[model samples]
Each structure stands twice: as structure tokens, then as C-alpha cells.
Target: MRITVADPAVPDVVALLSEHLADMHATSPAESVHALDVERLRAPHVTFLAARDDAGDLMGVGALAELGDGHAEVKSMRTAHAHRGAGVAAAVLDSLVDAARARGCTRVSLETGTDAYFSAAHRLYERAGFVECGPFAGYGEDPHSRFYTREL
Candidate 1:
């Protein structure tokens, strides 16, 4: 798989992001859904990534939003449903962490849903050295949210 910064104007990227957003809303409450929309992902502070197969089919997506102060937040992570369990999410995640380290971030964190829909994400983060942590950045304590952080 090839991972690169996603172009917001690309149709495939747009559709994949739409699917991702629908999944988040399907599993989490409106207030609990932290996934960024295409517009937010286009902000200068965010670096959105897309993983694609050799044929250029989008397989997964993730983003790292620079939070300043040596910290960054992982955002909008999702693997194509058809590609689940094929390691696409892990690859995208590893690349985002690498991007964080390259940008001089000391810690990277994320806010994900606490529901069963997030189980795979929790497992992926844990295996990659992330640990449960209190919310960082502007986030507050919420029953529907689970936070994790990892030091680079």
C-alpha cells in the first residue's frame, strides 16, 4: 500500500471520507463524534493521509493535526470496510506517528468512541505503544470518548 497526503479535491478521497463520517455517526452520538469533516481536514493545521493499493484504490485514511507545543492529535482514522483486517489501518497509523515524529511532536494523542465500533482502533493503538490517558488539547471528560496518548 502507498500512503500519501490526501488531496481534498480527489473524488475517491471525498467518497472514502464520507463513508468514514457516516460510520462515526452510526456508532456514536453527535456530540461524541470527533471525526473531522473534509473542510476541517483541509485546514492548514491538519495533515490528512490516504493509503491506496497499487491500483490506486483507497484502502484507508488517517490524519495528524498539529496542536502546537510539541503535541499533535490523530484524526479521522478509518479503514475501508472491505479492507478491514488486512492491515490498512495499522499502516496508515504507523505513517501518521512517523509524520508526528518528523514534525518534532513529543506526544501524539487521539479521542475515539468508547463503543464496540472502536475496539479495533483501541487494539491497534495499544499494540503500537499508546496508553489510555486523560483528554488533551481542548477536549473535556466525556462518557462517550476514550483518549489515548503515546510519547515519541
Candidate 2:
């Protein structure tokens, strides 16, 4: 799969992103939804990417949000339902981490749901080197959330 920073106006990327957001909202009621809307992804601090096959089919999407001072947050990670378990998410995540590192970020963090619906996400994050942590970057403790952080 090819991973590239994208302008949210790209039609394929926008459709994939819409599906990603809708799936997340369907899975958890209390997730700290990231601001992945088109304009938000174009913000100075955010770097959004969409993963695509050679044929141009979108396989996954994710973004890295600069939090300043060598810190960044991972956001909007999602793989197409049919592509789940096909390494699409892993590829996108690895690219996001590399992107953060290239930007001089020393650490990367993320927020995901803690409900049963998120167990798979929690597992994936752990496998990717994220460790459970208290809220960072202004997020407070919330029973509905699980926070993770990793050194880049």
C-alpha cells in the first residue's frame, strides 16, 4: 500500500475518512473523537495520510497532529472493514510514527475508547509499543477513555 499525506478534498480520501469516522462513532459512545473533518485535517498542526492500493483503492487512513515541542498525537486511524487483518492499519500506523519522528517528535500519544468494542484497538496499540497512561495534553481522566503514549 502507498501512504501519502493528503488534501482532504481528494475524493477517495474523503470517502474513506468518512467511513472511518462513522465506524468509530458506531463502536463507542464516549470516544474522544479527533477533529478529522476536512478543514481540520488541513490545519497547520495536522498531517493527514491515506493508504491506497496501486489501483487507487483506499485501504486505510490516519493522521499525526503536532502538539509542539517534539510531541505529537496519532489520530483517525482506521482500516477498511474488508481490509481489517490485512496489515493496512499497521502500515498506516507505522507511517504515522515515522512521520512524527521525521518531524523531530520524541513521543507520540493517542486516545481511544476503553469499552469492550475497543479491545481490538487496545491490543493493536499495545503491539505497536503504546503503553497505557494518564491523560496528556489537556485531556483529563475520563472513565470512558483509554490513553496511550510511546517514545518515538
Candidate 2, residues 1-152: lDDT per residue as tens digits? 88998876788777777876776677666346643777788899999888888998888888899999899999888787768899888888899999999999999999988778788888889999999999989988877779999997
TM-score of 1: 0.97
Candidate 1, residues 45-152, lDDT tens digits: the string is 899999999998889899999999999999999888778999998899999999999999999999999999789899999999999999889899999999999999
Off by over 4 Å in 1: none
lDDT of each: 0.91, 0.85
Residue 57 displacement (Å), model 1: 0.7
Model 2 spans > 4 angstroms off: none
Give model 1 RMSD, 1 decimal: 0.9
TM-score of every candidate relative to the true structure: 0.97, 0.91
